[model samples]
Target: MTMVLCIGHPERSPVLPLHPGARYYAAPSPVGTPGGDGTRGRPWDLATALAGGRGGSMVQPGDTIWLLGGVYPGRFDGTLTGTSAAPIVVRQYPGERATIDGNLHVHGAHTVYWGFEITQSNPVPNANDALETYGPDCKFINLVVHDAGKQGMSFWEDEGTSELYGSIFYNNGTHENFDHGVYAASEGGEKWIVDNIVFDNLAYGIHVYVGSRHPFLSNVHVRGNTAFNTGAISRDGFQNANLLIGGDVRTEHMSADSNLLYFPGTTGRNLRLGMPRGDNRDILVRGNYVAGGAVTLLMNGWAQAEVVDNEFIGAGTIVDLTARGGSIVAHAWHGNTYVRDPGARAWRYEGAAYELATWQKITGLGNTGATGTTPMTPRVFVRPNKYEPGRATIIVYNWGHQPTVSADVSSAIHAGTRYELRNVQALLGPPVLSGTYGGGAIEIPMAGVDPPRPVGRTGPTPALARTGPVFDVFILNRTK
Candidate 1:
């Protein structure tokens, strides 16, 4: 059972690059100072060295324990088992400094890959939890858990489910007395994908529950990471934003992408889904760039979710979904780009009785004129011509909320003109220009223009033709 290859390039397989610093081995290096052999630079200080006494012994799937940097402080129960074919890793030996100061909390049958820092030298009483995996694939990478009072990195997969990357969950115990940073409870599919994590002063950066498809366990990729100045302290406690993918049992692969979420005076519902019950279908809120916090993305009980291509800046009612007892069925929103309180008016598609013709507006083909209806300020480009490769074309200028600057289409553009476009993903009536004549006395010249309200903007009330009436399409760029 020897399969540790993650390193690529020569042709591609490369991904094995988790050596932030130390890698010293000896003492049989398995657990550390096993029978005292302690070699590779003469290492020995795992708690008091000598492998903490090798408690329940097992750790042998390919065995690899490094921990080398500094400060490793108390109350550390032990047992590091492993074997689903070779899976024991306790990292940090590629460079140096791997610390676990106190309260590792173990029960039995192990698999502990605690990388960097697993802090705790002072406060940890409220509930108490610095680390707990009860045993499963058990992996806690690039770790950095702090102040712990409870749930810094708690996972009880029952049998298997544990994988946290780039961790740094801090201050953990104020929100309601500690909620979670990377806490997974375990049920069916048993999953955890906590990626690029970093939650300041606890209350949730990444907390999943019971299992099922385990919400499919998507990236948890809470990107960029930062929950500064925390929820403040609502009379005695605080902590909200940063991320909380709860679960009473609703699995469909939930995902909160490109994160930078923040919560100042917390209350609740930053990115919550209370669980309520089950059927929590495929949730994937994309490219998140949220700011304040009110109800960034929440969907209560009876599940059915899919909020796509997200970019809800500022945050207020970007998404509420509603589900205490009523609405929320077969939910499907498309091409999201809400930006209300972030700086001001920007609601590409606010929710509440929402049904933009079934959502799929991801436009793009070429000749993007009419500027999505004036206002041009929200800039983001890149789609010159690859005929759509993985698809990504954002031209959201005057964006949503029925305000495309007044839809002018710039008098039908003419600066070397040559069009043949069709990249209009919904929100029709403003960006429709046409003209492809070749000969035959095509003397087209209108005086009081008014006759061309049809390009592509289906159902759900797609009939608002009164903004500037100018039309002159045909801006092809295929050169085919």
Candidate 2:
């Protein structure tokens, strides 16, 4: 069946492919009467369209609800359930804007809500989240949630995988309420929080507070987001942070990488990775640029994490390992650059302030330098392609000011295997692969131009070393 697609503000709304046998309903409030059917020509109100009575059929799995441009009030509760293959989609109408001056509650599984603006108009005392989800496999994408009384968005008490992508959560929480920008607490599920911006909250910018209700939170990935100006307000002498991972729970394979966190108003830690009761294992915090906090990173009790290839600039204490409580079995601090104020200690270990030199000598860690400005270290990860069986994708991130010269690929490939690189020129400007792969340890040349510095900087700035180019290498086996 042919459909008429509208186009104006493409990012606010995009044309979605119609699922087979799925029904469509439209809600154009402030213009459409309540008695009309939910058709494109004669749309219904938000309540009638969502409740699905006189103007529309009941919302079912694989259904699509199109919200036209207008201000909608009341909570948009997700009471309808859907499957993984065919999810219930609630999206804005193309070329128009939809604003919800209320809250949202998602109680159903496998649902998606995209491209809307959620804000608080009345400003109630102790107000709930602008968007709160307790369902599994639910996704919130490209939405703006701001100025809430409490958290901007939350994923609480969920046991299923959820995702939040390309969204903005800002200006949330009150002084008394002490809320966060994004508060996530799941029993056990994977969460992908990527490409978002969170700022200007009373508490943390992003918080993962998993309590003792769950055994573990696994595969939690927080990547490529930006957070700034957090914890400006205090609550009962407890200030917030840029990011906080706390609770009486366990975590596995949790990674926070390539994020930009800065400008903390309080003296709280910029990146607090653990709590007094939680056990975090195999956690990786890498390639992040953090600045303007009293403590850059605080590893509390029962945590074994790797702080690698990150730049921590202008902090009182770059790393604090005093509160670890002797529960850290394995921890590594490698290739991290710290630009602190002079005479400020770089680290605090076991209740004693130590410079980088003293700490490195005692623990045999952080061998890079005393000032913590180390050369760029190359990081690579390879995984087999799910769609194409005989191929793999290589991710190479250069965490320095200079371009990466070569990358070791011994662990990724086998000996005597002939492979061809695809999409090499598109990523790094040109193909620069060299040398034969007998594969005990082979190096691949990756010569790319370094990024140009800012125009008016006199000397070397810390911001210049915080970012570099990243390349993706797609490889196909030619031997078979």
Candidate 3:
């Protein structure tokens, strides 16, 4: 009940005129192979150019098919109608290498497309989500969905969907079921924007469920992609967390900034919050830079989230709020930098033992006794002095500039102490700041003991050692 079919057009190459809902079946490239005709010479057999008779066929409604370069496997039942004022385009012309297999159906104002490459190695329940858009305003550009039998790209419950920009969801590793390299079930508002490049998956590389199955998902933008080693949650199914988040009540806005999540394991939680449990407020995770893992950040069951300035290397509880029980409310933790991986597993906020005084302070220690201008800027915050042998010294001066204005002072010493230098020359005006650049004469060998208290809140403790000189305090900010 519609018409207008044209394949391969740069200027004009229309030589198969048979109107009436137009249908031209011929996609040859394999089978005795001798100059296939999809273009230049002999090119047809993408299931008889998009299904057309027993071998597997189905496609009508101004059908415009064109795929020919090489590699065209089999299986593809069709239905690509056009109604949004005429919309149904199956593509592959920029150095074509088309390939599609089984399961791909779009109806009504149909707009099922093709950019090819969906390989499955057994285990075909969801066909590893090799491409789906339940036709609303359907869209897919520069596609490459790899290794599937589970999840690589699945979208249904459409309502004006759009996915532009080169996409590539790889590995999709699944033994049974973890699948999720890119999944979106919009309820209606629709706008699942994934600037793709997901890798090594078994689960949670990009997954979003908007309750009641596709509530037209609102605008969701996951920028500059690269989610490494995705979370494979589900050894036996039931979902445990691997970046699986449910609709924030019905989508309005959800974001993930400057992507790059490395080596994540433990089923999930590189960035997971509220899944199908409903009521998820605005989500905004900023400046990503994660490494290895064991709970980098999991505010499970969210209801108001915002964890900022990220950079947590080799994680182990960078933030794992125990399920936020009791209907979690508004959460906010600023400036993240948890680089404490001393053989892992030490931080636990629930059973106690959690220390983060800005990650154990070391506020610039000083001792400028040679009048480089008296600037022994000391700001020591102490609390670890059980004295197996503890020592403290502070004295810096800048009475008004000195004999050559030399200044240098650094502190943190404890291992059986012995800097034995009754006087190594230079009473202040000889070395204006040397030790190259990391500063000079610095020695930190601590033992002073008693620095492990967080099991039951004995409180008031932090500063076992931090004796100043963070770059030999030299004032010039002028504010005397």
Candidate 4:
């Protein structure tokens, strides 16, 4: 389908509202350093500007700091703080792209960072996160971060309530099972992880699992996200879930809704809620689509919950409530579609196998939902890049495992637009398939493309990384 809303540059989106205050600063540094005054012509370096300038201090709470287009290599620590109503703004120069080839640490609170490419071109000592957050009420929007030794972003639990929205993550966690596309944690307050595309990471995507160091997390809302092809390509050959939350710690009531998950060929489950060691108090899993994995809710599952209107499609045991000793209290497990080969064990409740009709009657769930023999057909969503109309991020779901899927881009670009599609997994490699767009459905080649291989994580990878029909994410740009 043609992208209607996300038709603009992925970096500049959720289109920022007008910030008050009549001040602006510039960082036109050729290198990230501490020189130059804060002026458009003589802009200070990124480090200087973020440190509040040289002579005294030039950055205010609501002022805008523009980093002129170019590569800024090195580590950057930002200490600019702002209120919830008015946060400090650090973004790329208009119409120009900036690439940070190191690490970014947000040490202050209430700031809005926009439009930039943050990567780990220079890996840290221990394969740490490319982006680390320490402040609260901050918004890291419309950014692209990848190539980390560990996670792409460490949305820490220090202050909590930070947002990682409208961003893209891939090719990270060269360190192995330890990292993910997003490593989000929260002890309290609401953490918003919304409308982002995370795929092809070395490990799981949008992971909320924690360890013994700090085992208690609460109030995390993961919504409007798409994750696929996780752990398929790895240094250690481990295929993990597309999306997972909860671990060995105590997890509070959380929700996973309106998301898309697919693990086409891998043994990875599309989505997993809670781990075996953790005791989940309450949970809600609704309106999600899963393929090639079961929606398993692990641990002691006699919790207050609602698992409704979701699709769980896998070869066997499409849905496992993780039911423990007793029935789930205050539960609503209906309107959820289950798909499997006929006669395959389709569901498990309290460790007992049951057919769809029997399970529905016994638990009074899936009464409105139906069992399906087929998986979701392949479909594509084209998101136009606002800055350069020739560039766009295309999201493809190849649930049926078709070698090719087609999409119409007439709304985003016109005819005669010579375009090439390259799987994000191999951006440096030649395009997987390319053709001139005639303003109609164009086929995307999806076969033998996936995440990289690595081994450093402590979490368990799939016993065997399943391999099947492969492509999940791609970048579409105009070709000469």
C-alpha lDDT values of all predictions: 0.42, 0.62, 0.43, 0.69
Among all candidates shown, the one with the greatest lDDT: 4
Instruction: Tell me the tens digit of each residue's lDDT in model 4 across 360-415.
Output: 66665446377776645764656665434576666766667787778766655679
The RMSD of every model to the true structure, in order and in angstroms, is: 22.9, 12.7, 26.6, 5.1
Alpha-carbon error at 230 in model 1, in Å?
23
Model 3 / residue 21 / CA error / Å: 26
Which digits, one per residue and each the tens of the lDDT, describe model 2 over residues 1-480?
111111111122222334734455555466655676666777767666655535344666777778888888777766556677777787888667888888888777777788788877754553778888887887787787877777899876356677787576755765343588898776676787765667556578998777787676667778766665565433332245688766677766777887767653236678887776776666788877676577887767535677788878654777777435554447777788777643566677766788777766665564743354432564454433321233343444434423432433444456666655533213223334433456643344344333222122122322211112433232333334
List of clashing residue pairs for candidate 2: none
Q: TM-score for model 4? A: 0.80
Question: Per-residue alpha-carbon lDDT of model 3 for 1-480, expressed as tens digits?
Answer: 111111111221121213434333334345313223333344455544444323333444555556554455444534444554444556665445655653344433445364556655443444445555565655554466666666667766455545433355655545444467777665554554433455445556677765554343555655434454453222432133334445646544566654545443333356555554565556676655444456655544555666576655443555554333443336454666566543344344333434454222211111101111112332211111111112212122122222222222222233323332110011112322222223323322111112111111122322221111221111110010
lDDT of 1: 0.42
Model 3 misplaced regions, further than 4 Å: 1-44, 47-70, 73-77, 80-130, 135-144, 147-152, 158-180, 186-198, 201-204, 209-228, 231-242, 250-271, 275-278, 281-297, 302-315, 322-480
Poorly placed runs, candidate 2 (over 4 Å): 1-25, 28-36, 51-60, 175-177, 211-219, 233-238, 264-266, 323-329, 341-344, 366-480
Please give me the total number of clashing residue pairs in predicted model 1: 40
Candidate 1 residue-wise lDDT at 1: 12
- In the range 45-133, model 1's lDDT, one tens digit per residue, is 46423133334232344455565565556566545554555544556664466666666765434344544667665543434677776
**Residue runs of model 4 more than 4 Å from their true location after superposition:** 1-33, 122-126, 157-160, 212-215, 294-302, 361-368, 380-394, 399-471, 474-480
